[model samples]
Target chain A: MSDMRDMFVETASRLFRDYCTPDLLRAAAAGSFQTQLWDAMVEAGLTKAAVAEDAGGSGAELADALALLVPAGANAVPAPLAETLIAGFLLGEAGVVVPDAPLTIAIPRPGETLRAVRKGDGWLITGAVARVPYARFASGGVTVIAETAEGPLLAQVALADCKIAEAANLAHEPRDDVAFNEAPAQAAKLTTRQAADVYAMAAAARSAQMAGALQTVLQLSVQYALERSQFGKPLGKFQAIQHNLATLAGQAAAATAAADAAIAHAEHGAGSIAIASAKARAGEAASIACNIAHQVHGAIGFTAEHALHFSTQRLWSWRDEFGNDAFWELKLGDQAVAAGADGLWAMLTAAA
Target chain B: MEALSFAPPPVSEEAERVRAEVRAFLKTELANRPPFKKADSWNGADPAFSRKMGAKGWIAMTWPKQYGGHERSALERYVVLEEMLAAGAPVAAHWIADRQSGPLILKAGTEEQKQSILPRIAAGDCYFCIGMSEPDTGSDLASVRTKAVKADGGWVVNGTKVWTTGAHIAHYMILLCRTAEPTANRHEGLTQMLVDLKATDGVQINPIYDLAGQHHFNEVVFRDAFIPDSAVLGKPGDGWKQVTSELALERSGPERFLSSFTLLVELVRALGPDPSPAAKIAIGRLVAHIYTLRRLSRSVAGMLQRGDDPAIQAALVKDLGALVEQEIPEIARQLIAAEPDTKSTSDFVAVLAHTVLNAPSFSLRGGTREILRGMIARGLGLR
Candidate 1:
């Protein structure tokens, strides 16, 4: 186990240092998503790293997948690679014939209704899903739908079946509103509960990404503190900046640890306890990391020219992407209470 | 550098069985003990109970059997520590010697020292206290002015150690004092000596009552105290190295954080089935932080087992863990209404009282927040 963790640390460090350099992050922020980097990850088997080997990919565990994503996040890579990989894996896990291409899952907005009806050989998906991340770039999409008789279902629909309207999220990710009008779709074997489970897992993965991004921002901020001089010394020489960076480092470490633990639990079928915990911690940490990086960088971090904006912006977006910190917090608390006193004690003791 | 990744090592079957055994022990032996009471676990220090644990070979599970040690793996020891702390057992009596002093002596002490001390410590028949801090030198150990002069195969030590927990009851103290001349470097010429507490020759232990009127802490003065050269831990001038390594053990552990865990459990219980939104949020945040800290701490333990001293990482865990623990009381206060009178004997309320009283020491003990942050910043290369 120690070796595995060390391997993760080694892999993550290399990815961040060599691939997710400041220039690369800046390019990502400027919408110059590196196709070479994406392709390199794919060739390195990182894209479908969590999928079973039987499904034409490395059967890496969830932790391994998360380990890869952390660096992807720290670099603020603009491609929706994480989302695509997750959507593909879920579809493949459910025995769906995942297309040999990138896929993205669109989160259903409040008041949005997705209805599916049986057709001759497939189903017709009707309704609009809002805030679909990387919708325009996906070859297909995995969307949530409510069926009248069959209940909640996750269906895989080709991008050709839906219209992707150009949209920009707060963090400048290329999102879009996916509008489906009786589009032909194939229902995967995933139920509504399973879909919710998948959503939670995806949220956990995205949280890992956010954690990675936050860690990067922290490192960058620390580096800036060392390089930038104040009164006769590096800015880092000041206790105030030192304290700020320490706090940020603590938060980043906490978030990273939480995400890793969550992935471990999820892989072992531990349910929402782990996912909710990771999501909550990562969400909060990402927001704080962004704020701290900007604060430490001062005016330079806020400017468009600095690379810090790349990670900071991604931190803001990824935090809200999978579910905000508040949402996950509620989920975790409700789950704990539902487990009752004895259950809570058992869980705490087990963790301890 | 590879991508940032965290894949915990797999748990062994023996470790799993050990965890079960410890769990069973807690359920049976510690069933009646309140969770909050168990919060201190070993730090709660009841001599009789600690002696019982020693008898059961639970005190020094990982030590060599020849020296009254169990010679278990660090992971197995880790399991035991986690179980004991989770159950909130009274382990305070033997915690110090079992944790550091005994280990230090085993590694650096002469065969005679090990033969004399290890068995007693393993038996929980002896206790030890840290004698490092002075009135003027808080976090700055090199700034210590306590003097120890060589005198015919022995040393004459004279100094005052303040904020020493368990000083009143400890049988001995592992004192770090200046053994040579003060020089340009603050870390030069120091030594760790084991001083017997029962000696009335020139030592005085005075109680320093805390805000809660608790006498858990004391100030000990050693005037003309004689200590044989054999009493020194490691080589003379190795005190700085020994002390720094000891701090890693001190700062990183389940105890550094989770001090107020009993209250957190109580708060959840008090909330019942349906909790307010605010309460839910607070509890969720707390649990998340706890989970995160546990992983980080565990990883540090893994590092230690591999012969690595993760001082910076340990400091990071301690600083963050302390803050999370300190916040529990405040969050609990806002979540649950205060029962002014003794209307409720709920475990939650009792745990709250205990945590509120102890929270201040979370950051103060081991190392102050200011000192820890400085270390962390330096670790990050900020300074």
Candidate 2:
């Protein structure tokens, strides 16, 4: 199992490293699609990495497929790779045909809903979703879990048919405000439990990405401290700088462990508690790691020319994307409280 | 910088099975114990309870069976230790022996030493304390002034060791002292001697109470205490190598993070079924940290089992674990409005006072935060 994951990760890392250059990232942030990079990812069979072979994917285990995000995140790949992997799972499981082009997800925030009603044999999707990741580049479609009169159902709506207001996060990645005004869509029945699992998976993916990005932040800070000199000595020789990097390493280690635990749980069919903990822990790590990395690098890292921001900016944005630290902490805290004091240890041990 | 790897801990059915057994035992053993008393956890010594645990074959679990060990996997030992810690069991009597000293003996002891000491340790009839620090040495252990001079049948040690935990109740002390004159290389010419604290002549243990009025810490003055040649551990000049390995075992354990756990239990109990959003967020944050630290600590155990030197990784765990352990008290105070009082009747207040007073030592003991971070920086190739 570990060998298979190693092979898969090695392949994914090579592809991402070749295409996610500083020039490509800058162009993608400036309202241009990374066409060559996207084509390479599609040809490498990475777009549908997690789905079963029968369902138009490489038939790789979900854990191995999700492992690709770590390197992709390390390079700060400015694309909808994480979203596409998640979309593959949702669409393949709903028995819908996984598309060839880049796909995005319309996950509605709390107090918001996207509705789907019957329109002849097909369905029509209405309502709006704020911050639909990569909606502008999802040439295939936007996968959504829409509310129906009967129950919640899955829908794949064409991006061309919807209104997309281009928006960018801290890292300049596209997070569009997409509105579907009676857009024609392919629909399938989906349970409410599955819908909740989708949310958990999204949060888990963000955690993995944060874990990878934090590693880069640590590397950058350490390298800068060693190479950059002041007062006739490298900055790393100073106790203050060394201690700062040590703290950053600690945060990165915690996030990586948390993300690894989340992926393990996801593969084993135990998701909620682990995912919640991962998101909360990774979110906190992101905040601390970015602060230390920036402080160590000084003004050079703050400039656009340096590559440190490529990872730190994503960490800053991804941490708050799919339910920040406070959101998941509340969920986990509620579960712990409900279990009471006597049952608290039991709850943790049971999950293990 | 080399990337630090903390792979997922391997799962063992036997380990899980042992976890259930340990939990059941703790349930019965601690049924009548109150939170204030349980707060002592590994620091609370009880020889009778240690004997009971020894009878259960928990001590020396990973050692050879000939030395009264159970020959269990490292994962099984981890499960037992964590379960004991979570339930706040009094394990001070056998903790140091089972954790580092016995393992050290098994690694470097003479045949006679292992034959006599291992079984007693496994039986919980023997106890050991470390004699590494002195009045002039804390973090800089290589600069210890303690020295053992050559004698007729053994060596005579002379120097004072301070801040020695459990020295009063301990039967033996693993003394680190110079066997030769100091050279330019300070770490050289050092030896570790197994001094019989009670039987050895000229050894005086004076009590040094902590702020909480506890007698766990002590000052042992050795005025020419004699240790036999057979009591020498490994080579005479290998004390530096031996003690550092012993510390890796000491640094990355569940005890480092779970010292203030009893207070968390009381806080949860006081919060009841419903709590404010602030309280829930605070509690959830602590839980997330504990969950992550457990994975990191367990991964270090796996590395140790594989015979890898994870000294840098162990330092990182202790550095991070101590922070969360200390933070639990600060967060608990904010969530509820209760003044920390050691003499209070309320369980919450009493545990709070105990944890607040003890939190400072969490970072100080094992290794100071500054020292551990310096080691981490070295691992990162920055020092």
Candidate 3:
């Protein structure tokens, strides 16, 4: 958390709070996208914060860029801020042209690898990538990591060139499934640990976002408890409500701490252990945090109009998105078990 | 938004160096200890092991060297504590003295008290226990009625202390007693008196066995036990401040969460390399929590090192840690088909059984969950 990073957070956070109005959220959730908000973000140079300066980005530190996701998620900003920044940075890292619009990625999961056939000047991508976020309205394209005859190749393919069956996560953000039938793509330079790197970056981003959302619900729960009265006192005055909010606060705190660790480690290229713990911890914390938050908020929070739904729903969706707790936990558990009893502590304390 | 701050300090190279040294030392020290034996963790006392730690200058590490401390950074001490707990080294021998009592004595004790007590504590020969809990007063510590009446050149103590861990074997006890009539504030008249267990008269230690049938806990009765005027560790009516100041240190250690760490290791070993996805998921969730708790707890240590009060942060760690540690045995039971058995000859089952029997105390020990939650609520400005 440097002073320069603070500027990015302060500036972008103010912009988000001003532009990401409830009306804008409602419109975005109702299938009408908020272009003006995205414009504000782009004008503020947040979307390209992670891209290299030579590649026409704001050249903000990767950590500074990642930190913005907290406020973005906190405000429930219905935009592709984290994804675009990460994708743009990935493209630059692979020595490819950084896109100027909203971006998403097609990363292969544990046992799956998307393929690309080297065809002429560009590569022909062939894969059925599920849940490519923001692809439906992504003006730029989706970054795809395709396995080729020679190692792995990175490519950015236009959504118009592929079949996108539009869908939405619980938060109403587009999470469309894309099927590439020999889709022509810009053959970006290959990157090391291709899919894993992207997934790690995305998981770290999601962890930050999840941290933000957890903070939102926690505040909502506490504020609600303080305002809503019963038994001749405010809900916050009740022992039960106070305890529940305390639990929510713990969840929120753990998620925030976990997110900070994840970003810190991810920034240092600490790999799966750091990234996995961040996502797994944040997702796990969110499970308890969201439940406790909604429980504390009671019926008023259950309504679609309530802002609590915005954060909680996003948390539920985000946890399952870029690899859930179970998905990442298995990876960590595998490494730990393989290391055996003696090596477990070493693995755990290795990053520190 | 105003949650107690735990901005993790920059990763200390010194701490990492200490971590490596501790790991290497533990490797040789615990090479022969079985996992089930390790499951006893910090509760299992071994004077030899504690002496080895003391020789390494690991005990009373953050105190001044003149007081037999190494003057190491708190993070370095934290790294050592984390490694010890993870490896299940027998740290109970001097855990209390190292964690709180020695620090309290250094902060508030007379120079004579520090000269006579600290070096022995640092050498890991002397042990200490908190004489705070009584028969009726537990979480409501302000209501403690242990009396210390004025006597010739001293005070006479008459009361009983309950649930004092390691009391039967501890060399000394930092006795919290009522020194004066209660004022408008119940917490005002209490004082901390140093009690020499071996030298004291009419002091009886009766064992209070745990569910595991262990003698780690005790009931100490004092009937007109003389505490020389010099034995008062701090000023009269200052026990509340001293005890309150020590609360964060008592609650924020790796012991709070790592009590059942051996159980987690045993669970992982049982699951092996290629278990069902479900087992892996359970293990992963546990690992993630352990990692996060370490970060939070370490952050508290940094705060403590920087001379900041992190009572709220410490409470948060202790509360969340108790939930996670207690969740181990229950989750481990479901992840595997074996019933937790202390004598089944299977280390995993035995460790699970030990943990099952012990997990209930994790929340009960430092501060009960209800009390911790109340503290956290106050931290959240809800109370």
Give all TM-scores, in the order shown: 0.92, 0.98, 0.96
lDDT of each: 0.76, 0.88, 0.86
| Window of ten residues with lowest summed lDDT in model 1 chain B | B1-10
The alpha-carbon deviation from the true structure for residue B232 of candidate 1, after best TM-score superposition, in angstroms, is: 1.8
lDDT of 2 by residue, A43-106 (tens): 8888898878898788777777788888888888888988899888777877788987999888
lDDT tens digits, residue span B34-78, model 2: 898899999999999999999998889999999999999989999
Lowest lDDT 10-residue stretch of candidate 1 chain A? A187-196
For each candidate, the DockQ is 0.51, 0.75, 0.66
Judge the docking of candidate 2 as incorrect, acceptable, medium or high: medium
What tens-digit string does per-residue lDDT give for candidate 3 at A101-179? Answer: 7888878777766888877777888988887888887778888888887877888888788899989999899888888
Q: Residue B313 in model 1: shift from native, Å?
A: 0.9
Model 3 stretches with alpha carbons more than 4 Å out: A110-113, A267-271
The predicted structure with the larger lDDT, 2 or 3, is 2
lDDT of residue B20 for candidate 1: 86
Q: After superposition, how far is residue B39 of candidate 1 from its true place, in Å?
A: 5.0
Task: Quote the B-chain TM-score, candidate 3.
Answer: 0.98
